[model samples]
Target: MTDLLHDARVSRGQFLRMMGGLAAAAFATACSTRPQTSTPSGGGQATTELKFIGVSDQKAPMDQLVAAYQKAKPSVRITASYAPTDQVQTSVRTQLGAGNAPDLHVVYPGSGSAMSMSQIAEAGLLADLSAQAWTRSIPEGFKPAFQLDGKTYIHSAGSSVIGAVYNKKAFEQAGVEAPPTTWSEFLSVCDRLKKAGLVPIALGAQTPWVTQLITYALVPSTVYAKDPTFDDKQLAGQTSFAQSGWREAMEMYLELQKRGFFNDNPNGTTFEQQTSMVATGKAAMAVQVSAVLPDFRKAASSPDDLSMFPLPGAGDAASVWIPAGVVVGLGAAAKGANVEEAKAFIDFLGKQENINAWAKAIAAIPLVQDASSTIDPAVESFLPFTKDRAVPFMDQRWPNAEVQPVHFAVIQELLAGESTIDEALRKMDEAYQK
Candidate 1:
């Protein structure tokens, strides 16, 4: 029957006979399809109302944008709700799946994570944003984060780089002269900090998401810098994480752990605690996404006490690559009753002025090419790499949702002294196949 289904000469009747019970059973459970209709691409009929849901961590900018959007388009009344990052990720997925999703909500970039654009889009939940005018301005490297199958589903106001956020005071205390520009120098700095009786890197392995940051920061140099086509090769079944530069990156992480470079009992530390360690000068540094620099500032005695530097994951400083991608971005629900209104708001949000203003308010790097917005000074060091040296987050190119969690779990196991680099990589390969 399987062979007949693929036979070129098989008649329709023969195909049906081969499919038999499977065909009838599928039809019996299938719901009737409803033709989808999209509102006019020209900012839809002066939307009267919009429902917006966003992460509370981004509330200030999101709220400000909503208010400004409402004033400019006074005909539309926008009501918004915000929650913690973790809660927003979970709730958005549940709501989108239940057909009760918000008219507009925040979605993570790329595939294989909770509330990620790829995951929701695969479920037929996101409104198509391919026609949005600003889509033309997005850089080619960044387009993949907000798009899937050449169709855009989310609109990122900007992007953020991941790197080592360090304490200048702690570095001085350890007698380190400057930020390292190579992997060996970085390890040496770590050794110096550890010898000075300081935690060189504060890690929060108890939070699974935190486990992926260092790997993401390192892999661009370890993997993509050498072979930019690594992900393409991976998709073609020509590569695997266990056998690629990813293994080198993950092994480096394990080496850092073995050398006593991280805070003790990392598995018990929370993200907030890890940030506080560096903010308070108890730790020399931490690998983190640039978006959270504000949280570290809040924990510090002086806002200027903390700053970020690009993590040089390769031995050759000139060849080092930086990790940059869209942070959480906005998405519209495909089947919402107010779909048109939501889309209008999205179009407005993508305007250069709006994108610039939103980027400034959140300390993000604006995505629109013409936007006259400045990046946070803390991340200015990363600007040089933005053009051609940036790589997307490693997991963003993952094949499915199962792979990320597996990567995180295995890393935690390695840090907990329960697994070896080989074991972790093997588990990752197994998950990648699924």
Candidate 2:
């Protein structure tokens, strides 16, 4: 898996093409029918049941697409459920190990998490999706996220950025007219928001995955913006989290907490509470991925009040970068009885219209776009930076699954004042080596 991951290096040009969208690839619009047992409903019509489990961010699009699929193929009925990242990672992975996983389940891009494509594919638990037409359209730079050993294993609609999802009303209330462009200005804005009696940042550190976003949002500027080859150097054992810009990023993360810029008792807050705080204008913003913009909008009285901006992680606006990576996606279980049926659903998701719908639902940049693709306006501010100023999510390039969970744990400890930056980075470095 390590050799395969190393082989998946993406050049700058290829990365640009990916963000810009690849040429339209032809896909099969005809749905295939398969033999199934007859059901009592619909006058003894055939019925095939497939179960899918995914993270909460996937629910909005999945609900819409699943309904479309069922309408197209009445014989197949999909039952889908959503859960938080930590829960899906733990329970679904256990199900995979036990060989009774759902027909389709959430799979993180690249290889840093237990449910990542490489890790799951390495275990031979993910069905090969290389034959799908959509796989042919995947941009070369993004192959690492969608494929392992040159075989596509997951189906994702597009990429998303991690930024500050802020409430316009809250910002107005704080007398802040615009989003900050530099680190110092960001701090000043936070101070103003805090003084105005609003939580400058709503952080849900108790939810493990939520703990990593602030650092992920900051590291691109502190690390990659200075040395684009930092991941390579770390993989070569020439550098580490402790010795690189990771230290600076960690310090910055802690600095936000130290300034009381985050909501009180962040370590006890859940992602739901954090989303509510920002959506309803109780807080100015939350550092989060663009993929969850729908959730924030759903919780708000007026969705238009929510918009996103790149979280400035550097003193210089030009040096600041953002984390843009493939959104969490689903894969068919290789060992499942309904593997073919599940793969069909993934194939349905690959169609252009379906991809557009999914991307629009999550406010992501479509993996492959055409005239029909509509990017969410909230993320328009981050587009100029996508060409050269963005890096894939840090975990996507990690050598093992251990590093990410360790990252989540250390951040929680730091937020709770139970750990120091040095200690946190040390633990992360140790996990990376493992």
Candidate 3:
């Protein structure tokens, strides 16, 4: 596990097998167990209060599961709050550094960012979750995302894909009958939407993390579809973003904006505004992770108004691919006073029923499925590509934390016309080598 963590690599075969298992697994029913609690010394019912800070994508699932946990374990109380990704990453990391972290906080899978599971675990800030029963069930290819040094530190329900979340009514309004299957067709669809007076794509570039989705959606088809070993090559210093399909992906991203397909003043728009635009049919679609489908649904007049389709990044349908990776999750703080209680709560979440609940709320596939597990219909179109064409989110295999933020910043700069693809990739390469 330590070697795997250090390597941060999962081969294409392994990844495919993991996806196969997720699609085929049929398991026996698993039961839920409540965390143990002790009575107060004064003889009154003892209560333990736990604090959790997570990102917006987690709110729906956490709200549902938290209520269920409270109902089952009245002695333990959890107060969870959520904020946008950029804010949570800054504030929660600060809390962790100051030794005043919440009992549990948001953790991204793999070692991509400052608050990723491996990064926090390496700093001795995350508690070991290896003892939990659910840790035993993590797919072999996904272990690197949840574990470091052979110990589980994070709990994510399942993986999600990055794609175009479109409003069906808006598509109809533009005279588009179906999702496009090729890059040229996609452009035609966008052109029609624009002609119909709808924003073809709702890009909220003002939000740092949202800036990367367009590139992420394109890279698998532009880069990995041609060379599946791209990550390995990049890790070995055999190639770079400036020297590969990443340039094409970046150019394709700008081509959309160059044609005025995006909402007006994208750099000034917020993620909330982007969601509202698509949900309300003011915009036809947004390139986003499937995990946030619930947020889009919540903001819409009818959840069924929206659905997802793989963004075709190549001119040929056969060459198109998608990005699928572990969703962001939470971890318990190692130094918290309620460490055991926090662990117990995580343990409770480990139950198959709770995993189903969490995954269902966010439209994710359950990490380990049983008869009860359900995959959202919106993502069904992506299943055919997941086993072969999909790649893990690029950051998951990045050698260090610096590269992702650099990627984010460069995208923003490129969007603002302050940088070129050459300069942007060069900046990312420098960060990668750091």
Winning candidate number (TM-score): 1
* lDDT head-to-head 1 vs 3, winner: 3
For candidate 3, give the lDDT of residue 356.
Answer: 94
Clashing pairs in 3: none
lDDT, residue 370, candidate 2: 94
Please list the residue runs of candidate 3 whose C-alpha ends up more than 4 Å from where it truly belongs after superposition. Answer: 1-45
lDDT of 3 by residue, 124-146 (tens): 99999999999999987678788
Predicted candidate 1 versus true structure: per-residue lDDT over 157-194, tens digit per residue:
88888999999999999999889999999999999999
Q: Residue-wise lDDT of candidate 2 within 152-183, one digit each (tens)?
A: 99999999999999999999999999999999
lDDT order of candidates, best first? 2, 3, 1
What's the number of clashes in each of the models? 0, 0, 0
lDDT of each: 0.86, 0.91, 0.91
Q: Model 2: residues >4 Å from true position, as ranges? A: 1-46
Q: Residue 353 deviation, candidate 1, in Å?
A: 2.1
lDDT (0-100) at residue 58 of candidate 3? Answer: 92
User: Which ranges of candidate 1 are over 4 A from the true structure?
Assistant: 1-47
How many collisions between residues are there in candidate 3?
0
Q: Model 1: how far is 177 from its true place, Å?
A: 3.0
lDDT of 2: 0.91
Model 1 poorest ten-residue lDDT run: 34-43
